[model samples]
Target: MGRLYQVTVVGFKGERVTVDLCNTEEQMSSMTVEQLKTKVVAKLKINTELSRISLIFADERLDDDSKLLKDYGVQHMSVVQLVLQVDGGRQL
Candidate 1:
């Protein structure tokens, strides 16, 4: 079975859209945040560039110096939050 992931995209309007990674593999393990952003862009067929969005990785590890990743190892069914904030004049 392929690894599954829950990606939540939060908009500026306080609306969230969750997409499921059903047929995805464990490729995220070997990819950086930038690489993963590219994948997400391609997967979602986003017209804008992937770098235009803010990608947040919340894993299962928390450090005193960093609050980015939590202490919950990301697994097959991990749920991640992606906040997509557009500029004031930027429109889809």
Candidate 2:
């Protein structure tokens, strides 16, 4: 077992979820951004596509699915904001 990290995911309509993630640098680096988005959608019961979901931390938006969590500097007790991407390009 690896060290557990508490990640707070804030989504639309103020919906939030706290997820436990592995803190090992190697493990975190192996996980892709898409996997995290899927977990958030499943927890929030949101019927949204993975491509339309955006994860943000420290005011920086994570846009690459191929990037790892460690690449984004996600660590223990990190707060991530989840936003739904709309087609109109409107700011949320």
Candidate 3:
């Protein structure tokens, strides 16, 4: 079994959830950002597509879906911000 870490995911509307994640250095290093996004989507019950969302941590935006979380310095008890990408060119 891998080590478990506590994580808090906060949504744009201030909705937040605390979840326990089992992540190992090896596992996370091998996982890509897209995979992480999928995991977050499942945990947060997000209704939007993966392309319409982004994860932010420590005031930094996570953009590379091909990189590992460790590369982004994501650690235990980290708080990740979930933001919905909006197309400004589109009329509401």
Candidate 4:
């Protein structure tokens, strides 16, 4: 038997998107931050570079793509906040 959990991706104005799922605990832990971000971008239907997307969980910023979800102790049904970073310099 395997463990399955959901990770919801939320954006501005309560834009909810449930796109991350793991077939097993091991798989979930092995999943990297970048992988989740990619899924979010696709599910959210946003055309932006991977670097432009920032993920936040438990009031902590997930800035390392190479790090696994387990590194942050992501729990079942974890709510990940998506922040779309603007590219280039300021518009001043």
Candidate 1: worst 10 consecutive residues by lDDT?
61-70
lDDT of 3 by residue, 1-92 (tens): 77865568887788888755556756655656677688788888878888888889888888998877777888667888988887884311
Q: Ten consecutive residues with minimal summed lDDT in candidate 2?
A: 20-29
lDDT of each: 0.47, 0.80, 0.76, 0.82
> What is candidate 1's lDDT per residue for 1-92, written digit by digit as tens?
66565556444344555655445544434334454455556655666765465554463211222221222353444454544657884533
Q: How does residue 88 of candidate 3 score in lDDT?
A: 88
Per-candidate clash tally:
6, 0, 0, 0
On the 0 to 100 scale, the lDDT of residue 29 in model 2 is 61
Q: Where in model 1 is the C-alpha error above 4 Å?
A: 1-29, 59-75, 89-92
Clashing pairs in 1: 60-70, 60-71, 60-72, 60-73, 61-70, 61-71
Q: Which stretches of candidate 4 lie over 4 Å from their true place?
A: 88-92
Superposition error at 27 for model 1 (Å): 5.8
For residue 1, give model 2's deviation from the true position in Å: 2.4
**lDDT pick, better of 1 and 2:** 2
Q: On a 0 to 1 TM-score scale, where does candidate 3 land against the true structure?
A: 0.79
Alpha-carbon runs more than 4 Å astray in model 3: 89-92
